[model samples]
Target: MEYIVEKIGMSRTITVPSQAVTLLRVLDAKVCEVNEGIAIVSYNSGKKMNKTIEGQQKKYSLSSEFNRFVTLEVANTEAGDLDLTPLADAEVLKTTFTTKGRGFAGVMKRWNFGGGPASHGHRMGRRTGSIGNAEWPGRVMKGKKMPGHYGNIKNSVKNEIVSFDAENNIIAVSGSVSGANGSLGRVKVAK
Candidate 1:
């Protein structure tokens, strides 16, 4: 089963040699329609809404709080509240989230390039040093380790479930998860 969740940041368990865990809060969602294993689910997000969302609310007979809609693989057989039973029995989860964006980065920060010597006469301190061959392949090659955009890309990680608080809809999983705190992501039961 899949659920939309928000990253609650990372914390450590209260035991001997505490293990690091990433906490995720499952958002309250209602299944609107089901087709095979995928269903259109509605959940509350920000207050921003448009006519299209209003029409969806009318069609699904949902309240104004449930302004956002997404299609997900759910355990519900029919349209209703999202089932949380699957998560209780799940031993692992595959989390998919976007990494933090570090826009317009340099080669040193982006590709971990060792810059030129920090001497007084060196002009290639942080620049890409000699990116071409002498008349052999005069142009810079494609997929070179030069600087450009970095991060803000989709990343997936499989984590073992540490604990699940059903009443609060919070899940603690082993290790770290991508994205900043409070960022939204999807978690699918892997095991």
Candidate 2:
């Protein structure tokens, strides 16, 4: 099953030394329409609402808070509160989120290219070294790691479940997930 979750920042477990974990909060969702196994779920997100969203809310007879709608595979048989029972048994979760954007980066920071030498001779400081090819193809390689848009891309990672607090709707995952705190993302039960 898929659920909308928010990144609640990172924390460490209180054991021998410590173990890093990322906390995620599951947003309350209502199943609006169900067909086969896929359903259209509505959940509260930001405060930005539009006429289209109001129309959807009116159509579904939902309140103003449930403004954002997304289609997900749900365990609900009919339209109502989304079934959270599947999450209780979820051990592995596949999280999908957009990474923090680093606009127009250099090769040193973007691709981690060892910049020029520390000495004061070469002029390769944070610049692309030699991108031109010998004259065979007469063009830079297609997949060359040149500076461009970095981050803000959709990334998916699998994390093991550390703990789940049903009362608080919080989940602690063993590894880190992308995106900043309070950013919304989707979590799928991988196993």
Candidate 3:
């Protein structure tokens, strides 16, 4: 099964080592419709959305303001209890919550491309050097690392142990997730 989650905010570190805490918002997930080998889980929203979004929601009963939905293909159907109450309001869906955006960034920050010497009088410092050869190649090769969009990509982080509050029904996952606070995150099982 898959879940649709949200990037709520970063949590404060409670234990040792001092690592940043990542927070996720897991709505109540419900089995809307199951057909073929796919389970269409609805994460439903109470807010009003645009016509296009409303149409999609009506067609699928998807929960959430944004078009953030995950499809899970069933490998086999066995007699089991799939606890989906977490999708309702208890369990914080765990997934690598990508950011809404990070604009163009240099290789140094993006790919950790160690910038050139800072005090060697080298002007090429911090710049992606030698994109291609002189005349033999004639053009920049494919898959060349360069400055570009930094974040906003869905990255699945695995095995985030979660702690839930029985009273409040707020699920807390350890470590940093991603994205700015209150951004829509598509949560799914980590493979």
**Which portions of model 2 show Cα errors greater than 4 Å?**
none
* lDDT tens digits by residue: candidate 1, 1-191: 99999999999999998999999999999999999989999998766999999999999899899999999999999999999999999999999999999999999999999999999898889988878878877888888898899999999999999999999999999999999998999999999
lDDT of 2 by residue, 1-191 (tens): 99999999999999987889999999999999999999999999987999999999999999888999999999999999999889899999999999999999999999999888867787767787899779789988789999999999999999999999999999999979999999999999999
What would the TM-scores of all predictions be?
0.97, 0.96, 0.63
Output the better candidate (1/3) by TM-score.
1
Clashing pairs in 2: none
Who wins the lDDT comparison?
1
lDDT of each: 0.95, 0.94, 0.59
Q: Worst 10-residue stretch by lDDT in candidate 2?
A: 117-126
Give the candidate order by descending TM-score: 1, 2, 3
lDDT of 1 at 36: 99
Count of clashes in candidate 1 = 0
Task: Please give the distance, in angstroms, between residue 142's alpha carbon in candidate 3 and its true position after superposition.
Answer: 2.5
Better candidate number, 1 or 3, judged by lDDT: 1
Query: Which portions of model 1 miss their true places by more than 4 Å?
Result: none
Better by lDDT, candidate 3 or 2:
2
